[model samples]
Structure formats: structure tokens, C-alpha cells
Target: MTDGNPDRPVIVLVHGAWHRPSTWDATRAALAGLGYETRIATLPSAGTDPSPTASMYDDAEAIRREVDAVDGPVVVLAHSYGGIPTAQGLTGADNVTQLIFLSAYLLDDGESMYSRHGMDAPADTSGTFPLPENPGLALYHDVPEDVATQAVADLVEQSLLSFTGTVTRAAWHDIPSTYIVSEDDRSIPTALQEVMAAHATTTRRWAGGHSAFLAAPERFAALVDEIIRSR
Candidate 1:
């Protein structure tokens, strides 16, 4: 990152399930070099409770703390289940200028994460690791080969509590939202990603896998940079 205008603010990151704030290290370094500040948030993963007592709002409160710290409006990027928190986090955040979904799930009011895909009215409550409570698995076969293998290895069961949690506020409609769809995403099929993200005002496609930030950080960072700089 060369010297950038300090007045433009920065882009903030929110990662998905089974991940941590540290997972965005590479992307954060790339952005900071470009003169942007980034705060990568870690969500509650399987470790908090293998007993499965996590809710998306619980994750959102974690994100909201970061959003509240921004001095100016920011570009909020969410990956996978992280979008649930992002959507909810942006609700009362005056500093949140935009919401960007990266191969993520976006639901409407009263809609739980699983309900969007018709997986189940309420996600399963079974206690399992890696598979969690999602019905028949929500992961897909279209993700890039190398990325998918690592993704599988990194997989951990997300809380059934989060999947079944309902969001009262839908931030995408209120914010100038964008969608960066990964064509090779295996977890969520590309077709479904497109259809589900149709409501975003701006959408871009990338030829990467679900973990593009890990597999291709620079490219993903550049796209995020462009979004933030344009503001």
C-alpha cells in the first residue's frame, strides 16, 4: 500500500464461521500498505460450545463493537456466515457506509440463515462437529479443488443457534451494498449465490474459491480497495 489519502477512511473485515480475526492477516496487511485501516473480527466458533449455543446476534454484538470504533464511514466486508453479523451490525452503525458480501448468505427479516435456502424452517438441533445442524450439509461441490480441500480440513461445525437465529433488521436494503461472488465457490453454488445476491446495488464476480482471501489475498484486497477508494 502506497501512501493514500487519509480522509477516505478504510475497509473493515468480518470473517465467517470456524475462522478468526487472524485469518484476515494477509488481507489486512495488504490493505494497510495501501493506506487503509482494517479490523478483522473473529466470530464465535465451535470452541465456544460444542454443545451449540451460538446465535448470529451474539456474533453481531462482537462486530458492532468494531463498527462503533470507526472514526468515519467504512466498507464492511463479510464472508460466509459472517454476513449475518454484518447485516445485523450495520443496523445502528452510522459509520457503516456499505456492506459487501463475499460468497455469503444474506437473509431477510424473520428469515434464519437456513430458511433462505429452504434447508429447514429451523436448522437442525443435532450436536455434531463440522456438519453442525444444517440439513444434508450446506457446502457444495463447485468450490475450486485446492481451496475446497483446505476448506474441508479447516471446517468445524457452526452453532445450530446461529443458523436458526432470526435477524430483525436487514441492512443491505438500507445501505449501498455490493456482492462479490466467487464463481468457484463450492460451499454455496454459484447459481444460488447469484440469485440470492440479486438485491445488491452493485455486484462483481471473481474466478476464485470460497476462501479467496486466503488463496488470492492480493486480488481480493485490490477489489476491496477499489470499493473503498471509490467512496
Candidate 2:
């Protein structure tokens, strides 16, 4: 693999459940403008399969493949449910220098997303998880109306198994990490975010909803850049 830039580590972006890689278009562009190369990991759990069977472990494998494909050092930024797989994926990955959890679920070993949310795992995990009735309000309330509408339209059904699958290994236990809290997030409660943030090496609070990157890509990218430089 060719090194996009030997000076700066590649930024590997992991999108949340129900979201596609395209959701990071604005943030990726902004990061590129800031002299950082970015790569997006496509989660198998958030695909077009009607009877989705992919679990968080499958997503972890996908993330590992992306990280292993990078030639230089890497910095992974995981959003929402992406953090669970990310924590499991980066195990033994020496090239990954830092992990950034953006309004993400920082789960421990044997902890599933459902368990993290105080919900019991469903007995059957063969189907796709439905999106909220109003994703615009739940996820992108801070974003502009047009952007929120487009985001809602682009959402796909997430795999139920992904949420039910427990974390086998947590990479955050070994790797240095930073957690950025979305203060106004509705999807994941702010208190829950704070609880998860305690596991990170550093924690930051940003004023915005769950999808802050969508609402303010430039500002989000700047904050990311700042975090990267601090390392």
C-alpha cells in the first residue's frame, strides 16, 4: 500500500449504525483540506441485506482490514455504534496510534450495545433494526433542514445482531484514546456519553447533537485536527 503521507497518520473513519460511508463526505473533505488523508471502513452490519445476519464481530473484521491496509500510522475515529467494533478490531494493531470516539459507545469486553443502553439483548437477532420515526430530530437536529432530510433519506436498516453481539475484546483497554462528547445528543443520552468518556485517556465536550460532524464539518474537522496534533 502506498503511504498517502508519511508525515501524518491516515484518519480511518468508522460510521455509525444505519449510516453509510457517504455520510462522512463533508468531514472527509474538510480533513483532506487540513492536510490529512482519510479512509472509511464500510461496516457489514449496516448494509442492504434485508435479513441481516452480520454482527459486530463482522464489523470488527472489516475495521481491522481497513486498518491493516494502511501503510503508515493510523488514527481511527469511530462514531456511535462504530466504537464497539472499533474497540474490538484494533486489537494487536500496532500502527494505530490513537482512537477517537465521537459520540460513540465505548463498550467493555462482554458488553453489547443493548446491554450498554440498559436493554436486554433480543432473543432473535436475525433481522434488521428499524430506524427511529424521525431520524432528523433524533440524530441530526443541529444540522440544517436540507442536510438532515438528506441524511434521513440515506439511512439504511442496521443489523440487530450487531447490537446484540457482545464485545469479545476491547482495544481501548490497551490503546490510548480520546472521547468527544456531544452535549446535546438525543440518540445517546449525555450522561451515558460521560460514563463512557471516563474510559478514554482524554475527554472533550462539544456543543451539538449526535451528528455534530454533519452539522459543522469544518469545525468538527478542526477539533479532530487539534486532537491529532496533541498526540
Best by TM-score: 2
- Sliding window of 10 residues with minimal summed lDDT for model 2: 1-10
Model 1 lowest lDDT segment of ten:
132-141
Clashing pairs in 2: none
Q: After superposition, how far is residue 64 of candidate 2 from its true place, in Å?
A: 0.4
lDDT of each: 0.72, 0.91
lDDT of candidate 1?
Answer: 0.72
Model 1 clash pairs are 1-33, 1-34, 130-157, 143-186
lDDT digits (tens) for residues 1-231 of candidate 2: 122455899999999999999999999988888888889999989877565578899999999999999887999999999999999889899999999999999999889888887899888878889988888899999998999999998998898889888888899989999999999998999999999999999998899999988999999999999999998
Candidate 1, position 108, lDDT: 73
